[model samples]
Target: MNDQSEQERWNARYADDSYLFGTSPNAFLASQRHLLASGQRALAVADGEGRNGVWLAEQRLHVTAVDFSPAALAKARRLAESRGVEVSFVQADLATWEWKESSFDVVAAIFIQFADPPLREAIFQGIRRTLAPGGLLLLQGYRPEQIQYGTGGPPHAENMYTAAMLREAFRGFEMVSLVEHDSVIQEGAGHHGVSALVDLVARKRA
Candidate 1:
């Protein structure tokens, strides 16, 4: 889809008054508290409605949250304000987002399974290129098995992640943790049910 159409699609998905996903940090992300610290420059990729971004800000990190939908971003701004946190919210399609090299100390990518293979590769590479040396990446997403659950994420199997796929994509990074499991998650109407999940925590080599 073109940028405008993609924007419209996401805007429509987020047009509801309620947050599609809940206003809580993804469980996988919140579990990695040991790696987070005050004053880190964090990027929350595709941070719909600012849950993770606002949580990052609450942790004292300087956060930049990016999403394509204006509706989602508007809700994100309100969420940030309500939480008494400050997050720099940017509306831009990830397909064409200009990712500055070595720009962020931490990157949080939670349930961003909206892309097909080509765009996914670009985003994977972008994450690698934009992370500063020794920076941490906290990523979680559905595995192919999630198609059976149908609780959240796109139905495309190719859009799902595998541990091997992620390891190879982030090969040069120091793998701090990588796990695959099935769990029951409740994050709102968007993601609620048994889920086939994969989590990856990697640190860029200094």
Candidate 2:
């Protein structure tokens, strides 16, 4: 699907009363919170329903939450308010969004699956360009092997991620941590139970 169609689909998915991915930060991100630089600007891409973004804002980082779904952004705003934190919500297609170069201290991308290889590259390059020197990129997504688990994630194995793919995606950056492992994720109904995934923490070179 094109960006517009994808946005519509997500918007509809989030229009319901149920929280699609729950109202908490992803387990992997929460685990690595200490590695995040304090008091720095951060961007959460495809931050549907604002769980992760709100969590980051609570940690005192200036946060910009970007997602294509207005419904999701609305819920994200509500979440930030309830958490007594502030976050900027931007509605735009990441594929065509005008990202400012070297603008963020951290970029958080969790479970934003991009099956299109070229778009994935563009998104990764955008993440690299949008980070300040020595900035961090925290990424987590299901591995292709996740198909067997059927706990969550995109149906197409091609949309899944691998360590090698992430290594190439941030080829020039310093990889602080990279691993493919199994973990029991609990993030509401959409994402829960045991799953195989890839997690990476790469820093932009100074």
Candidate 3:
């Protein structure tokens, strides 16, 4: 999809009066809170509606939430204010964003599967480069089998993930944990129902 169309699509998705994905953090991300350190620099890639980003701020991470949708970023800002915490939200396309080197101690890449295969590698590499050594990468996405679930996520299988796909995409990280399973996710109207999922948490080599 072209930039304008993609932007408009996401804008409409977030334009809803209710947050598409409730204000709560992702279960996978919240469960791994013990891995986060206080006051670390963090980045929330494609953080729609700011739930994850706001949650990270609550954990004391200085967070920068980046997304192509202005409406989404606006919602994220409101979420931060409502929580009495703060986070920086940037409007930019991950496909071409100049991801700085070793800038963040943590990178949250939950459910950002908009990119195609080629762009997917670029996004993953950018996140890898953006993380400081020993930093953690927390990610979760729908597997290609999600198409069978008839739930949320892109209809295209190419936009979906697989264990081998992510393993190769982020190979050098210390293999902390990676799981592929079936689970019921009830984030909101955007993402709900039993789905094929992949959850990963790994650390960059020091």
Give a tens-digit lDDT track for model 3, residues 31-106. 9999998999999999989999999999999999999999988888888999999899899988889999999999
Model 3 has a clash total of 0
In terms of TM-score, which candidate is strongest? 1
- What does candidate 2's lDDT look like per residue over 63-162, in tens digits? 9999888999999998899899999999988888988999999999999884467777888889989999999999999998889998888787888899
The all-Cα superposition gives candidate 2 an RMSD in Å to the true structure of 1.2
Alpha-carbon lDDT, every model = 0.95, 0.89, 0.92
Residue 131 shift from truth in candidate 1, angstroms: 0.3
Ranking by lDDT: 1, 3, 2
Worst 10 residues of 3 by lDDT: 112-121
Better of 1 and 2 by lDDT: 1
TM-scores for candidates 1 onward, in order:
0.98, 0.96, 0.98
Q: Per-residue alpha-carbon lDDT of model 1 for 36-149, expressed as tens digits?
A: 999999999999989999999999999999998899999999999999989999988898899999999999999999989999999999999999999999999999999999
Q: List the residue pairs that clash in candidate 1.
A: none
Clash number for candidate 2: 0
